[model samples]
Target: MSRLEPLTMPVPQSASPATPAARFHNVEIILPRQESQAAAQMICEVFRAANDLFPGAPYRTHVRDLATQMRSAPDGWKPRTAIFLGGISTRWTLNSGEKASLQRICRQTPRCLFAGSAIFLLPETGLNTRYETAVHANFAAAAKEEDLPCAPAGTLTTVSDRISTAISSFAALRLLTTYLREDRGAFIADAVCDYLGLALGPTADHSRVSLQLRQAAGGDALIVKILELMQRNIEEPLLIRDIASQAGVSPRKLERRFQEKTRTSPLAAYRKLRIEKARQLLLHTSLPLTEIVAATGFGSRSNLTEWFKREYKTSPQAFRKQYYAEREPQRSLA
Candidate 1:
């Protein structure tokens, strides 16, 4: 990975030392009508975690619809930062009114972030014309056709002036962490990254279990694909046969490969992944046990409780309570 340049907010030269900064910074996340709610929820969760860690709730986040915003102009309220998420289809082009509204928003906002196919909007809004934007491989040809200044292939993210662009979900998370580090201190940013299982820099640490699983696979494409499938289907796990079929292998061969490489059965590995996910949600989120059970593919409260206790040697509620109790001092210091 290339070295990431520091992300800094441009300070006004006229500001004196005695000038007080705003207590809270407002962030606006704009989504297209057809876009998934997942991206918007992810952005909001980042800020929500930050607010819990910070004393003053430094970041205030809001979500808005792009179509609605274009139809009705913002009532003289501009956010400190505006983030645009990619839509389901990049085939649609912006009309005159939408383009004008976006241009005005980008001009007024102090910082703007474009993720995935949203980079195409830069040309239409006349923003980031001078910057080399990180374009996703899927959208690179379309971006170039639209006259976007695409960065070199495999470039994850780019920050130029007040604008930042990220090509993929991982890149977007990194970019968001950089922005958080810039706004808050490194401590707060690192804390959020750790909670989200995100790495701050190229050499930063990631989820240990995940990293170990990948390393154990030893670059076997089949095992890697199976692992990815398991991770993606955490909320609704696939049967071992279905998983093997999707990976283009027979169930017996899949089990043999797993035993040879990781020394664990496919069913056991899948159960472990789901339990790990449940543990993370228990620690980081305030969702109820029923919700966590549902989210982790556990069939019922009793079933999840049984498996969770077997793995962790403690009940889920007890674990969550103890974890937060242990972190109380750290929260106080923050």
Candidate 2:
């Protein structure tokens, strides 16, 4: 499995020039609740700092940003993202101007997104503000399909309001310093790619993207069988036609509907699946190169190396090295 890399630290509220890609995808600041006066003040401070940094950039041009119930927004906060999911049991209110809170909601069912899926839910955004997170990463090189508009991740309602104090504020400061010194772009790109590949699938392309099916029990059953077959005989040099026959679909139709939906051809997608698995084993296990090749369904080590390089721009050995060296440092801390 690929790992998620967080930004080393939050950026200082100072002015600095960075690419759009580098500017975004480097930080994931999860503000679970911002309803209190303290929350409002904290949000204001963040905005003031951002305004001081980039005086001209607009904020909150998108509607999703203004979805907050608050009447006023922070000085420089840009509400520039829209999120689309299968469905969200929205928190609604009544006509009496009293807040309406609902009970008995299904919580925490992890949503599964395939590779190359893309959705744009903000076709109608009325607010006008720019949005940016103060973090370091190369958001540009991280492919576009992976950079869909992000939605609020956690449940809107929480039961408790107990714990106080900023969580790990001191530790955050130290990490931020180190991150700025490092090649934050590469790490950020990795994080961004992981997010994209996760939502779309391992080989999703931007030109082709689709919405994820929310509750596809039957589709999921088919996915399991297909994935099992791919995993069991990855090195068989099988064609899409062969796989489709096994999957109960005609080659041409699969090419049309499935490939269009996924933005990647069946063979390419399967190769990605195999390579990703190969990548995992190569990094996690002490298995030899030949064994890894056999395990991932490559005909030979050379074959694996060639394909891995073509897709990832690095040899298997090099990929293993980078992944481990980059990953382990982050992992041991967690």
Candidate 3:
């Protein structure tokens, strides 16, 4: 069995608590490949921070083929990632829990002979928020058939081949990150190659260069770092000072930079980001309102509803209904 421990500490409100030298803490999860209930238990434990897995017996054998993997990233406060990998025959169903513990989507892979999977969870709110959108669109574009299964509430969605390949490609990331920090352009390129099997072309080349230059420019780098930190730990109720500390700056300095760049305080920006995340869950997932609140870092359900009303001029439930109603015709045509 694997152990899941929280590395995050409660962040205080005082700005002095943030120091210039503070770095984001890294939490490690290592799970060895197994076939029995222990494997299921281990997998659940590994993702307990965000989700719960209810593997049917027929699906148990599929776990036999999965290799143990490790992920060491800063804690994501609400949206925990859940992964479902099936072997040649897929029979697993995963339910994103009833509570708001998990926010981000999970990965489920197809029934590949070796490995297949796809991710299910919420979208990214900060940093490279469009990252999930780009990857999802690309994968969908290449998918000839939807092998992925979507079960009723409390069941697992089957993984698609494209999604599975994308997920499996990252199985070697423990090796890749050893030499390249995540901030480097090469790191992103390697990941794209591993996941998409596409070589870096001129467009990618230019994008990488632009990103590098931007990171090397000025306050943008600090902003990027802070965004990364927020993206990682958005589930936690972190104070501005605590976030600033992770970016290696003072609270006041980080706030000043945010105001200059976005015309909003850092806290306001982060809260807005959180609201957007909740909106994603509301629109894309059937998660309960309570879970959405928990996953989005809203202190309570009422707070989430209030925030939604403020941002969209409607309640979350009504918003979800309207979105689905508008999309029903498109879904039917498709």
Q: Which candidate number has the best lDDT?
A: 1
Report the C-alpha lDDT of model 3 over 1-81, residue by residue, as the tens digit. Answer: 343332222322222345321222222221223334343343332222111111111011112111222232224421212
Q: Which one wins on TM-score?
A: 1
Per-model CA lDDT versus the true structure: 0.75, 0.37, 0.42
What ranges in model 1 sit over 4 Å off? Answer: 1-22, 70-76, 87-89, 200-334
Query: Considering summed lDDT, which 10 consecutive residues are worst modelled in model 3?
Result: 51-60
TM-score pick, better of 1 and 2:
1
Query: Which lDDT tens digits does candidate 1 get at residues 1-334?
Result: 1221212222223334454445458787776655555667777777776665443435666666555544454466667888887743464356676777788888889999988777777877765466788988888778788777888998989999899988855577787888888887565677667756565344333333444455466647787788878888999999999999999999999999988988888898889888988999999899999999999999999999999999999999999999989989999998
List RMSD in Å for every model shown. 15.8, 18.7, 21.9
Tally clashing residue pairs in candidate 1. 0
- Model 3 global lDDT (CA atoms, 0 to 1): 0.42
Instruction: Provide backbone clash counts, one per model.
Output: 0, 24, 26
Ranking by lDDT: 1, 3, 2
User: What TM-score fits each model?
Assistant: 0.53, 0.38, 0.37
How many residue pairs of model 2 clash at the backbone?
A: 24
> Residue 144: error of model 3 in Å?
32
Residue 84, candidate 1: how far off, in angstroms? Answer: 0.7
Model 3 collision count: 26
